[model samples]
Target chain A: MEPLFLEGKEDTPKIILNSQSNQYLISGRSLPEDATSFYSPVLKWLDEFSTQTVADPNVKFEVRLEYFNTASSKLLLDIFSKLEGLSENGKKVTVQWYYSEDDEDMLEAGEEYSELVDLKFEMKTY
Target chain B: MENNEILTKSMIYDLFKEMTKENITLLYQGDFSQNLMKAILGLTEKKMDNIEVSTNVKKKVFNVLVECVQNISKHSDESKEPPASKFTSILMLGSVNDQFIISTGNLIENKKVESFKSKILMINSLTSEGLKNLYKKIIVGHSLDEKGGIGLGLVHIARKTGEKFEYRFDKIDEQYSYFTLKVNISKIK
Candidate 1:
């Protein structure tokens, strides 16, 4: 499958998923006016990636969000749940949650997501 | 200048005096759209940048502010006997002592008051851990209304600050009631 690259904006995040590289990234702010619509394509890509039969089948999801609204938070949870499902299917799926050392809120948010999802999460600080 | 058009000295003096007494740092009372909301957030962001507080505290204030204003913009009553243009709301941010206060007021149908009040009471009654559990439950459930609200905003504000939320309703006629919600965040700790 081809990679998906979305540019970041003031109200949206940058999303990059490369099936060949087995690397996925979601970064920047996510406060879209209509989060569902804004994230639909990325969700679709995830769905397709889950069904694909890859050679190695190791995935690493990196999330580095400075800020996100409540709606975006729900969508993020959905994304994590999807990845958890992928992990349950015997694929090696890991998640890296990145936040600044001083951002306690973001750190706590990462911890909460880690607790909720069944995927392996590495809390990375910058 | 005509009497109505001319600036009355007493009115001007009284307004400043009232503002000083209330300690209001920023106040906006008018129609609230997405553009206006962004502008208000920008203004507050610039103002908050100059203050000596942690990024966590700033995030808390910003999150609480967004939720409060969005609640007003999305759920406020649009239909009333008096024809109130359907988009008017008020937001006030102030600081007293070592804490920051954000207050928002808007019109709402009298029928929906009980549910909102009960929900707020439930939120206020929960411990911080309980609120976290509730937040997790809501996120997992993933049932949002048309306006994208599953009461997550209120839950987040409550969890972020771990502070008591102050709210009240004033009767504005038979059909409409004005709802005001206030959230306080301490700068220290």
Candidate 2:
């Protein structure tokens, strides 16, 4: 399946995922107008992606966000966990987290995740 | 500070800082996070600063602000003081030269501010790729605080701004302090 992409609004984040490139990305500020509706499809895609993955697949994803609401934050946890499963099951799932040059909050966000799990992650800049 | 002086302060820039008409100064309350956010987006687009904002920066600032606001709306019930409990927060969007500052004030205990500070500092030290990995780790371990955020809320605050997360703690009463978070949103090139 092709990755999902949605244009972000003032209250939502722009989401783009390409299953072919295996380069999934959820970027932009993600304080969605309705948290449930916005993230539901994204979560759905990830679920499908996981089940459809071939053995020994290489799945790459990037999440570059500066802001997300509490509800959306829960969804991020969900997204990361799903990707983690994919990685553990003999797949090369690389996650690239991009932030600003001096964004301490985003950096710490990455660190918190790192401390929480044993998996390795790539923190980057654009 | 007399009543007359306080009354005069309502004339826009009367809040200690000089402000132009384009600058935004507003307080947010109720369960109106979405409506407030929509209004903010319109203001941001209508007034582009000197720097070009890539879509990335725009998303970060907007997303984070909305989350912070919603947090106030959600957690207000926990407030012990009746008056302070009802007051949501002060959110302002203003600029100095080419720099745009988004500042928010909310009631939080002293310790939370310390944690918030350290978290931002840690995130500030990493590369974007490293942050990505960290995001995953937090998810699996469930390291997020109970109130909200995956701990990366502050992380995203730092990452999006490309600047430090400037904060201040003012003791409101014997119990809580008004925490303020500020960031600069540079225009994308």
Clashing pairs in 1: none
Candidate 2 chain B has its poorest 10 consecutive residues by lDDT at B143-152
lDDT of candidate 1 at residue A63, scale 0 to 100: 98
Each model's lDDT: 0.84, 0.64
**lDDT, candidate 1, A1-126, per-residue tens:** 989999998668999998888779999978765678888898899898888877776788999998888878888988998898887666888899999988888989999999998889999997
- TM-score (C-alpha) between model 2 and the true structure: 0.57
> For each predicted model, how many residue pairs clash, with residues at least 3 apart or on different chains?
0, 39
Candidate 1 local lDDT, B52-137, one digit each (tens): 98887887787777777777777777764565445378899999988999998888888999999998999999999999998888
Tens-place lDDT digits, model 2, residues B1-189 = 466764575764554454455555454444546676567666665654444665555555565556555555443223567645755566777766556677777777655667766776687687867665665555455643532552645554554555666777776666667777677766543
